[model samples]
Target: MAWVQFGHAKCGSREPTSNARACRLEPRKSMSLDRFGHSTPTCEAWTMLQSMRRHSQSFLIYVLFGMLIVVFVFMFGLPSTDSCDPQTQIIVAEAGNFEINDSDVKSGTMRTFGDTLRGGDKEFKAAQRQVLYNMVTTLLVAEKAEDAGFRVSDDELRQYIVDWEKGNPDQLRYISGGKFDKERYKNFLDYYGLPTERYEAYKRRELLARNYLTMLETSLVVSQVEVRDLFEKRMNRTDLEFIKLEPMHVEHLFEAPTAAEVNAFLAEHMDEVKAAFTANKSEYSTPAKVHLKEIIVQKNDKMLRQIGTETDKAKAPDTRFKILKKAVIDNSMAFDEAAEKYNEALVYRANGGDRGTEELENLSKQHRDALGDKKVGEIVAFETDLTYNVVRIEEKLDATETPLDKVQSDIASTLIKAERADKKMDEVANSIFERVKNGEEFAAALEAVLYAETPAEVPPVDAVDPTVVPDDANPADEPKKAEEEAPQRVKVDVAETGPFSLRGASYGSWSRLPMIGDAPELARAALTLTEASPLAPKVYTVEGSRVIAKLKKADTGTDEQFAGQKERLIQTIRQQKSAALLGDWRSVITLSHPEPSLQSYGPWVQALFDQAQESGQFKVNQAFLTPSGSEVAANE
Candidate 1:
């Protein structure tokens, strides 16, 4: 990789720049891969590369390279907040003789997501595991396809390209007047970054996988019995009237512990309380250092150079810093809330950026500047070329510890209150199911359990909105258990999942039952319900919430309808079975090569990667590898 200055040497035969004879070469720059990352490139470099490419005139090579760049940018985006490499090396995972690289997992993930790893690192981590599982499975199955004598020839690849060109009528301009123009074809291919020979090889592998799957699947004859069962299940859609409850939603129903109860809890559990305080003694200790919280903003050129330059408020760069400034500086939101809302790095975002306490000697220059002349409760919005920290000086603690005796009463009350809230969540949910199961109406059961207390008999309606399901029901989780504060007017809801097949795809997965979330118990019970036995047998717990569902209605479509849709149903079932068959192969692959397990970058590499940052070598573009990126976690 030589960067040579192309000009005529001591030979005085330079007619013009382009026509110059070969001359003494000069190194334009020394060897460095740094420019490839965040470093800016000179326009001269582009001019030189163009000149070099043209003199050789590798139209096909240039076109393919151009397309690859476009596809890469389209799928993963560039320089996103979470962008960092995964552990140890470029080749991240292995299976038998085959290995899955960072590039392979990344390209495969592009099938289901496009620049979708924006929520934060945890979401990216989960997606990474799932897609890695998908890829490993695909690779092993593809290998099996090859072993089963499945092969895609060069002629086949060429034919695929030609057919694609013919099929895309909008690209007809490349074949004007019924005659293909070679240069025009090149231009057209350039837009798509047309598949090169290497990419063609990848396609060939996938083609083999597809063919092998087809061959195996074609023999899957859906018997009459299976067809009838599938048809019956699909034709009969059941509706469920369900009551949703969460500990977070209804924990308010339980009042604080009585003085007598608090004293009794202390008498019985003083040792436990002492142990809890010892474990979380930081809550009572003050070190001779500064306590800080930061809303971390990634460094970018716009933020570095032109952030405050905008005079009009609307014209500001809408980076994390902009959001943080508005929330913490102007609008007076808590630093943690701002971090949770806007910080790109989950390590800092998780605990709201609290760096519990930092000794002055170990503080970075940036931190020192933010803290200079600032006392406790002060803040400084600060930045460097690499980061912009919305630093809040939470405290400047002296070396001191609050004795356990100082907070013994408060701890005892909290422990009892939390215990009661946990018990009450189940009690309230079971109460609803018990009464409703015993001939009580649904609305009456909810109102009596949630609002006003009465006899065990169910009472009246106290539904929230009743228009749409609560936002929490969108398969998102509730707050963790027992982190209760003041009483909240339980935001409970009563809704009905109209009618759906027990096994039908609702919102893309059967696990995600409509308006009830991934509660398999409620879904299974709903499927079993009929007019005679409408209520689910038990309260189901999901993400700190409980639910009890009743059957609303069931629709059994006519056999004539099944007759009309028989062929389509068979095809869908065949496809599903084929997918499951591939899944079986994946399970086998996973068992064979369990290192870099789907859940993580495996223990062997994790030990090497546990370093705060693998910023040393093999920097994975976090956009590509996603998951852990660099683990320079704030650990607040």
Candidate 2:
């Protein structure tokens, strides 16, 4: 959604062009580029570049840059102003015998960003780069297709253009009863300032590329065995959930340690408590942090619309920012109250915009500068490239160490709970196991043992009506009271690990139940379990932690499901093959461009474009590319 599409035209309709490509950065992925060099950089311009020495980085700057000047500016600075721009019609690259030019790339970028051009320079550069690459890749791959004896008939080319026009939605105006008007087509190209010959050549190149790509996709046949494997992986996996038995889970069953017992334990185990404190001493030590609340002012269309419709003031960022500053900072409103009243984004409005305590260094430079000299309860305003932050300093916390005396009880309590859990886990497990054997529901049994709610084996006879004394014998023999004992409950937590297959999981993927730790024993039990007897045959001790597992949901592959999957798997495999092929193709084309994320395994193609740049086979000027100008050294 961030990148705009030009391959598809939607008049008033939502349909895309048959060949619409959403720009992206990847090998085998598409992009536009300048065709070749028409003019060299001027001597003075060359002199300036030599002085700067700081060349541009890679096209990966798409990720580096932002709505602000972007990482592009950070890494390379602006491209020699406009002085470094190549002459018009300069050729940028060559694919087979075909030449790519500056105009093609410029036109591509224009079509991509269109009239409004919202994303500024970052999007424009990324789109331009992608379009050029796309053009080269299309031609190179199309040439290969032609060599493979793939011929484009005139009829096929015409049909491709017809499909392209249809994507425009108002295509009916150019076609009468499905017949395209040649004159109308000419007029259409003229409206876009494209010559008939150049435009047709572009369309024909695109048509050849598509046909070749489709062929490659069709050629990679998926085996039935692979399909079945995927089907089992997806459909036969078990949805298993389990809980690790911990002292806290059955805390209710443990009677609170008495003061005397606690005292005795303290005398014997004060060392353990001290050990825990030492182990987690850093947590007891406070770091330098600041507690603050903030109100965010994000620049958006609504704020502009609020200024006025179709007015000059509405288009200006400063005017909208002024209004936002007034609402968020210039007001007499309390910070907390203002957050609820004016923070337009839903995520920002919650908790009255409380950022809580954060390290002061983590604040942006602007906020840090504003808060540097400010004291508690002071407000400061700062702006990021994207949004304005109105902040209230609540407290500046200094790094402080907590005394051991302050946390002794907490340490003791934790150690005592650990002891209690160890004491109760076996008891809880054995009792629950017995109940399950006796046909009591496992869940109910677990719940009863956890919460100390196990029902009495036999209901106590109703106490003889307290007021209604028995008529038999002496009144001295009052009715004996009947009492029922309450069963001990061990509260526990149950966690579910959605679904996973045994083989796939055994191979180190999803091989363990959620919250139960990663144990092969648990994974096997989950897959083999049935709804009738969902519990594992025995309690499992995974590492030091004990757990009981149950199958939450079992999805055994049915013939009908397998039948549906086969067709889908075929389509999936074809897409995979196509992606791989395209990836390999791009890999070869840009092989010389140093990248960290490139394929070194599988098939390797000769780095055609990179080799060409080295061999003087094609022309490229990096200054115009802005970010890839490290290659500008070659021109010098």
Candidate 3:
């Protein structure tokens, strides 16, 4: 009865019955073979005997199978307790009934951040938090989409892939080798560890999310007033006048920060210092580098003809290369001597063809491959873009990091210098600014503070004598000729107050004005002022010189100009408003589902394992999650 309840069939029953004793006997339709191989018809005693024997054998077999299963359970444990069981997967976190596990977190991290996982513990933890947040948000969005009855049919998914392949020619070429092949595309996904079904499901979720966001954005509207205001801001021009201040001019105004001052500054801005250090640590870490010496020969028609046979024109370069290769291999001359003798580039020849230390990644693929794993003193030859190179690896250095102790002092010194320079410039600017506010002329104040002479003025055209009358001019015709002739030169007014001036530098415009140097900052500042708010002085540093300027003029465009731009401005405003509304909706949706607590996830799993080891509760077999050799090779 127990075996029947557990899904085993009862003896003599055509259908699997739950009750062993309820098995009904059917009419004798087939002859039964006895132990001696004789066919027999049904009789009550004989049928009863046959049923008992069949039941006995079935019972015996079931017991033996049960014993085998019991043995397996003792040896390998139940499915729920097995580490490799899908149902018993390690759950990192849970949202409702959905469990997020270690494998899922790892796969998401790899998909999003790639090899940043190999970075230091701080970087690794940050990447893990980011991946977890993204996964939780994506899951929430997908759940919402499903609740809204959004589903992607098989035909739709197939057509989406087809459209994507058609749109992305480069990707298609890479996957299908320059031809469209459905099977090849499927294989490409498989090779990258993505199955076709999984990819299609991901795309369907992405499409639904996009559609949902689009729907939200459609509700937002841009008013006419907003459009008009935006257009005015964009099209309206500004004319500016401002002073330019240079650090060198005010360097004497302040002293260099003392060591104590630098230390105090560092303490005050420790957050910024730490951020800079973290961001630029790579600059302190040296990459694996190679030093090379190369002999280069430029290929030309003459060289090709000298070494090539007449039969194949394309093979000429190869033939010439072979000759050069044989010459280098024969050791008739050293590489340096050959470079000096044959190379036309002076820098290479003078340096004995030394290329200096170079990071392998910075080199071209052909060069990197040739030198990457080669030994010192080994020679390699390669051809590139109409030139041949025979090179030798002179030295190789393993990548090393500069200790923080060594670079900390240098970083502190640089930061202190920059701060001191800014302080000195600000002090000088404020001093000149006060003088200008007190009604002293801007140019005069700048000259007095910087102890610099005023700029020389360009002479007016009227100051130069009129072009001398032609020696052969008739007296009566001279008056008419003089009237008809162009004036000797056109007289133009130049600004006399400012150190440099740009006339007609309109608001919200970049135009090169005559007579004054191009100083956009001066122009922009000048545009913000009017006659009523005159002399708004500011200092600007231009080309290592301090330019002190004050507003000279301001002008606004007419209403007609604005009217012409209204339609285009409305379109621009609508696009900006739609994007902003969409962004706001996304933010709200993301916040609606708070990120799962990742304290016990990602790299924290290692910490837990470490605690377990100390307590003799667990042992770690593998310590790190570095990519395998094949993975690294594929990436390279």
Candidate 4:
């Protein structure tokens, strides 16, 4: 490459025959050839450069055209508003075709999340989050289950509902507690502010989700060992002493008073009757919490008579009634003011016609009947003894507590019962103690024993009591001949019974036991048996029953025997392990997920667990989870 000199400055040197202006640039071109392998622009390269320029121009034009279309769409065609703007939409969430409106979100109601959780605390947001999570999770899980072909069948659902109804006998209380019989269900939904269908849908989802989870868990086969182990751990595990008060006979107090005897007594107690009248005058008085305004007649004597007549009738008023009514129809003034204007001779009218605190007892039952129909500011007309009585109730107290005077009879009855109980208990205690001293068992001495005898006929093999601990032979269980088998109950006619203990119960069907309520003493005696000194019979008194318990036997087996039963023992051990796992797992699952819908438990199962949580039957166990996830139980 050659350099050109221009005004003492070094420039590319021009070629010998080349133009000087072009030569300055021509040397730069030669430098390009050093970088590549070409010196000057070629014919083929020029054509390619022109084609590249054309392609670039085409791409640019396409991009600009697309931008123009987008701009146009955004400026004129697109819906221009925020999605969450309250003014733009009536609702936010939708369940199927149903819109969740602002009205659905409790505003000023007492049941609002604000009222239930926060009150006025900043922790309200956290509380809201918890509620939202639970609600959403419930909805999502149910939805997923439905998608997976899990559904409640009509027959199964109907049976489930029947069982539910059978279970909750007191469910009618939720149905307006005996107000309107026909509208009970409707009223209940209204009280909760829920549409009936919506509530049903919610329940369906919740139940289906629960059923799905239950199906999953139960399909998990807990072995026989597990079942037996759980049974052992649970059975006879709870140690509790139940103290029960005996039911006293109250019929003894009332020896059936004759009608003639009562009449003669009433005659003799005429002064007492007068005293009773004086004592309960307040009870007789109808004291209603009535916001009262009295309206008296302000018409001619003839008109008053006509108004009085119309008030007594059940039918519509006549021309004379209309004339009298129009005379008192003061539309502009308040009812109270109208009452004052109309009332002239009435008792309340003299005092601004405001019956401040009218005793309901003072009014006749019929007049009082119409009082309920009258609102806080409306005139109700009804016939009284003297004249037409039009009254407005400012307020009403439906029914107050019974006065002390009114309940005197009840008090007298209760006192009589107490006195009878005192007298009877002394007689009962003496009778019981004397019988024991006379060498008779306490249970045998009691006239009415709750513990009944087994039928003479042999009962079913499974009908034997599971809780009854069997008696052991003092000499030891001998290996008797194959023909000589043991009898169910031991006959100890002459020989005193051996040491008593709850060694173990025979596998018997539990439905055949005598009605023995709260056998605490028997349980105590059974629990405290020993071999050294055989305990004597202890008459343990418990609720609704007495027990005569004597120790039969108490002994531990040898290791040789344990070795012989080792295989059975290991099976037992395995079962115990399985049971333990089931118990722990059930406890965990039940605590986390409980059936809140089932409020009450059956009698047999009641002893197994605490009652439904929210009812305050069982204390909250922070350490334990109840069957219903509604509460954390505090079990000691």
State TM-scores per candidate: 0.40, 0.46, 0.41, 0.24
Cα RMSD of all models vs. native, in order, equals: 20.6, 18.2, 19.1, 28.6
Q: Among all windows of ten consecutive residues in candidate 1, which has the lowest summed lDDT? A: 24-33
Assess the local accuracy of residue 396 in candidate 2 as a C-alpha lDDT between 0 and 100.
93
Q: Ten-residue segment with the worst summed lDDT in candidate 4?
A: 25-34
Lowest-sum lDDT 10-residue window in model 3: 1-10
Off by over 4 Å in 3: 1-225, 257-320, 334-361, 365-378, 381-389, 393-414, 450-528, 535-550, 583-636
Query: How good is model 4 by TM-score?
Result: 0.24
Q: Give me candidate 1's TM-score against the actual structure.
A: 0.40
Worst 10 residues of 2 by lDDT: 24-33
Clashes of 1: 6
Pairwise lDDT winner, candidates 2 and 4: 2
Candidates 1 and 2: which is better by TM-score? 2
lDDT of 4: 0.39
Candidate 1 residues 271-342, lDDT tens each? 989987888898988666887887666565444322232123343334656767877889998777777776
Better of 2 and 3 by TM-score: 2
TM-score of 2: 0.46
lDDT score for candidate 3 against the true structure:
0.50
In Å, residue 486's CA in model 3 sits off its true spot by 55
